[model samples]
Target: MALITRLSTQSESFNSALRTLLAFDASQDESIERATADILKNVQQHGDSAVLDYTQRFDRVSAPSVAALEIERREWLAALDQLPSGQRQALETAAERVRVYHDHQRAQTWTYTEADGTVLGQKVTPLDRVGLYVPGGKAAYPSSVLMNAVPAKVAGVPEVIMVTPTPDGVRNPMVLAAAAIGGVDRVWGIGGAQAVGALAYGTQTLSPVDKIVGPGNAYVAAAKRRVFGTVGIDMIAGPSEILIICDGATPADWIAMDLFSQAEHDEMAQAILLCPSASYLDEVEAAIARLLPTMPRADIIRASLAGRGALILVQDLDEACEIANNIAPEHLEISTENPQQWADKIRHAGAIFLGRYSSESLGDYCAGPNHVLPTSRTARFSSPLGVYDFQKRSSLIHVSQAGAQTLGRVAATLAYGEGLQAHAASAEYRLNLSN
Candidate 1:
């Protein structure tokens, strides 16, 4: 018996089976929602006192004040300096690559004058401050720190405040090192709904941030969803996903490991392979069986594979690409000869890795592109986190005397048609005025 489900596009039931496999209930847990709301309200009302109380209860670390929870710059620098040479070099190199990649995504202000002498353009400006939420404790992700913070710095964000839970009051040094390398301005020993609240509503000690970005558990996701209007938030990411379109030319063992990479993230993560060869699918399944026992996270891989993973035999490479477009996976790997040809056909994907050697893990770590990507089919409409996420644009309009005379009549006519008398009068007032 195979650990992952096998499907054939020729089968009549394939469409229904695929739908069942793709179904993920994203509804918020009512109990968790209520709990998160209470935390946000308490934090908003009592300020730092409420944040401290929740931090003590949830994280088991009591602090004299929220200000005391601040992790100083010296500690971050020390963490970076004290890391083993290899680890320090890796962090520095990854940060530099991420920074360089995001630099190209920075938006600039531009203006153009009309023939009538009216100037219209856009003003691009970075957010004043941003808050980054990092999952901590046993699940430290220094990669996430670089992915979130480096882009903001590249966008010219003045301050990037990071909040991570120091469970049992022990901080992850790698996370601290990444923060130092990524240009974070402040760090706080905090997490959960309270952390989101502190960033959104601002306590006495912590200033509010313009936007919050990063991944967290259920309560944190709910808090971000609830406080969206109060402060901007990145998308509520779902479990990680990877869809591999294989030509069966790549080694079977390599494909198996690629599937395992996303499966190890969690039991809910999805991994799927689409290929035109039935024999190739069989070989990959055999590889999975042989490799499963050797992995440290074999149990998680097993569960995720059994629950959502699939080996789909498509009609051909063209059909495989079509199916992949529908899936809109977080990561898409085209493992074939001339992978770029298939990549050119792909309409939606958070990230695309071309060729056999271009592994998804490389992109996740140091491939010079943002690893913070859209998940759960959001790739169809959204984009990867980049410098653009941290900067905003303001429309610039400077009307010359003659231009306003021509524009005001059009504006007044539209306002009058909408039955807005005051609006029409306002536009009309500017009309026929001396320069």
Candidate 2:
């Protein structure tokens, strides 16, 4: 197994290279959309009954009643206490970091008074209840639990319910323990598109949530997209992607290993390196050749590297950042002499690892940043799920008679310009009444 793709600034073709890694077909087809729509409709209409049926069919768990959806505080306490002190401490530390970061993200309510006694402001209020979906089949991300729940908590949301797939009909204890640390109010043994439906529509045993946040497989992403109008979702994510910017400061072995880190995530995952040094690229290729053969997922990583991954030689740091912005990788790592300089030029990226010492995995677990990131270039418009995701904003306007009279003419003029006669008339009538 070897890292087989390489491109130089003079010869690189992004168009031809991009076409090869378009794997998994985007999880949205007529069948999937129709199936998700049906599930959403059924859940909305039948509530708990539909939820139970889907849970049993998909998760193999029997959650027939709302009582089953609630994970008792006692169960949570038991799970937390059972962990060794180190693990417990780690969870606590991660929780504090998340709490602190999101606390800073907490929005302040603001208002402005106009000259004519008009008051306008924005009011930030946390949602009453939110549901978090933690991917459970292949792995349990306690960090995800912290990232999702801590934000809601910081936003002052009253309830945060967690749902994870229990394929074997049992939730992971570590997940429960993490939930305890993060102040999640409930845990449901549900998974897949059905779990998303249950959260979006509310089942007999569960209340409909104001928002749903977290990552899941293609089925889950499709379900979230389907339910988006009825409830809010963070973003539709794809396979993990990482772009490393290096001038060969680190060993090629380290560079190659970092590429594999994201590649093994899935066959479609992308691992790209942008550098100005050709010899460094050669060394990294050789290092990949030696290191990839030893990994259990070597075949998967190799396919990912050959297809989606690349080593690109660029003209300089500025060009490298431009390419990174164009790609907008989920994780951007700057492994250069002055990484911060290169990092400043990155206009778009999901999460950035500042230096070689800052591994992407650290951010995934305990670096205090949300691991859920924008994927597939959505970073240009989206962001990592955070405290704001569980909150809603409402604009506030208070106008006295004098204020209304002063502003009504302008409002009417704008409305008339937009061909909205009724809107113009309403404003004109208000101005007349005030007069």
Best-fitting candidate, scored by TM-score = 1
Candidate no. 2 TM-score: 0.92
Q: Candidate 1: which pairs clash?
A: none
- Candidate 2 residue pairs in clash (backbone atoms < 3 Å): 48-204, 66-205
Candidate 2 segments exceeding 4 Å error? 12-15, 18-24, 27-31, 63-66, 416-422, 429-435
Candidate 2 lDDT over residue span 279-355, tens digit each: 88989988998999999999899988987888888888888998888888899999988888888898899999988
lDDT, model 1, position 311: 99
Give candidate 1 misplaced runs (Cα > 4 Å).
433-435
What is candidate 1's lDDT per residue for 226-273, written digit by digit as tens?
999999998899999999999999999999999999999999999999
